[model samples]
Target chain A: MTALPPKLQDYLDDFSFITTREERADFLIDIADSFQPVPARVASKPYDEAHRVIGCESEAFVWAVERADGRLDYYFDVLNPQGLSAMAMSAILDEACSGAPLEQVANISGDVVFAFFGRDISMGKGRGLTELINAVVYHARQRL
Target chain B: MSDIKSRGYANADKLVSTDWVAAHLNDTGVRIIESNEDPLLYPSGHLPGAVEVDWVKDLNDPLRRDYLDRAGFEALAGRIGISPETTVIFYGDKSNWWATYALWVFELFGHTNAKIMDGGRLKWAEEGRELTREKPDIGPTSYTAPERDDSQVRAFRDGVLAHIEAGGQLVDVRSPGEFSGETLHMPGYPQEGAVRGGHIPGASSVPWSRAANEDGTFKNAAELRAIYLDEIGLNPEEPTIAYCRIGERSSHTWFVLTNLLGFGDVRNYDGSWTEWGNSVGLPIEK
Candidate 1:
């Protein structure tokens, strides 16, 4: 299993310093801005059924690349920014799991996904976020 | 109640044609605003001289779940170069769902100069108008705002109860699944939904999408009048309320009633089903 991405850990550690929910959301949105949408090659294929993240409002997709050293780097893209549960969670997972070992990537927990934003979103959103984490972990386990 | 059809709800000039917006792209008094569910669309490409109004940051209070207060609205409007009387024309994706919602917020703040760009982004793109990648150089302006007036337009739970007791009308704009207590939320938004489902008692099922054609332009006044007045049996003199899961789509219907059909009394229950479905002892109908 892959350990969480060290850089994503760094982002969360640095994010933990932000005391305000509004400011944290602001910073996270900027991070979301930095995320690139899914590339056309993957998006144009028959992946809509296989790669579609369940329980998300927007179409959130994740496609990963396996390096020779057994590390997996994932790509996350979304159509709507207001699909905050999907977009934010996918972006976080992409950053957290990229270039990490497969099993470590599989080990990402619900707590990391839900609490990363520093605010308790609705139960429905929490469920969506969990679905996202599960998708990422499921793909990571499949890579092995 | 005021004659909303004649006056266009909050403003006389609330629905501007694409041609009107195109001709006035460089108009100094006009501030074209783009509000979308996808916040990233504007930075990519949008109508010239249009400003992006992020729903979370601009319309909503940064920390609270509520909307922006007077100072917050002022800051947002000022940053986008809108003055108290500036003609704010809103258009965006999703057939102007967020656009109308944004316009409603402007009205709540008593900005009587707000309007919706007819057909929104879809119509603009369909017409093959020139798109701009260059950001407009309009600098910020000192925009002051009055206290948000919820007197006539916004409907609270008690207010809705009173309206119902007083023989008011309610139009539920959610999908059939939601109206029938089948789905807890809109498709694909499972995370942001209510605890329960179903329609408010005495509310009629009138999905907001019915007001627009395939191209997103609103149906003519006659067609709109037929649905709300004849089919639904709503009279222009009686007060009416429209609601969706979170009030955005209902704002679309509200815009139709007050702006298009000019109903005398119209309100948008923004709290919508999320509130009604969660509250204790509130009656519902499936």
Candidate 2:
């Protein structure tokens, strides 16, 4: 385990502002509002090549950039019409892990990410969070 | 999709047009409920008079593995500004998937006055309808809870198994791959899926999408009849139970069978494959 990256720490800092499930959900919505969609070509690739995120409610793909400083940068593409929450989760990971140390990204736990939902999110939604975290961790570890 | 009225539903009033909603935007007795597959859609922009009702938050019981208790149902209705006499019109995205899901819950609480918007949000947008970011602040009212009637339209796992045991008609309203055990859940929605795949024994595979046109509105009665009554050979007089993963999609078929075609006995097995696939010793059809 490594020291928590500043950006990941910043996300945890902001987590205090989200007390209600709606607020936590709204935070993800805000992430969706700022998310960029994948290019047409990249989106059409096969799952293996697309780096598909298994276990999401939608087809999500990730690409990580390992910088000279040993930090990881992430870009995500989610292929589901109703996958706003997954996109938001990708955006959160993008901010938290991108440019952060690889060790920090690898160490970030799924539980802590969904703690935003305050133990009240649906069982299905809880799995969605875990899947997203698992995707991020899988990508980070592979890069590591 | 053609005019929904052409199909001649037993209660055609259950399907209202976007124009009807527009005309009744400020009408006190009509409470517009918007529940979407994507929870964030309401905040982005929605029908001016609609209040958001989440399937998970408002419909489910907090502690139990079931829907809200009798008092909780009444409180939820009142909290959402719905009274007994109010006509609840539902509409949302993903072809009104969550909208139908919410309407089914309303039916569980015996709110027969409920309705669905024809073509849902897609058709509304396709027809150049208006959307606003304004959220309505309607006053809460006293909504009396109807008696908990789980028998009429909802089917638990036990009832589903018994129906199978008794050689009853069961519709597995899931995708072909899921019915074949090739996929666990809808592509991307992995969380709602069970540990294993395949459907209950003796259940016919008729994906819920077959009941709807491409735009997400219900197909005409003739098309649905060809699928359900003719193709699947289900008798309208006998009871039919429909199930999907976690029960949302099946409600679409439940709405189609019970309301559209006038089937007197159709129940939505809400626990669905998630429950069935997890239970050990439960026979898996595939």
Model 2 lDDT tens row, B57-77: 788887788988889888888
> Which CAPRI category fits model 1?
incorrect
* Reference A-B contact fraction recovered by candidate 2: 0.33
Off by over 4 Å in 2: A38-59, A65-72, A78-82, A123-130, B7-10, B125-128, B181-197, B277-283
B133-167: candidate 1 lDDT, tens digit per residue: 56788798897788888887999989988878777
In TM-score terms, which candidate is top?
A: 2
* Number of the top-ranking candidate, with DockQ as the measure: 2
Q: Candidate 2 DockQ score?
A: 0.32
Fraction of native contacts under 8 Å reproduced by each candidate: 0.20, 0.33
The lowest-lDDT stretch of 10 consecutive residues in candidate 1 chain A is: A117-126
lDDT of 1 at B266: 94
How far residue B95's Cα lies from its native spot in candidate 1, in Å, is 1.7
Clashes of 2: 4
| CAPRI class of candidate 2 | acceptable
Model 1 misplaced stretches (Cα beyond 4 Å): A6-50, A61-100, A109-133, A141-144, B1-13, B61-66, B122-137, B143-145, B191-193, B213-215, B222-231
What's model 2's TM-score?
0.86
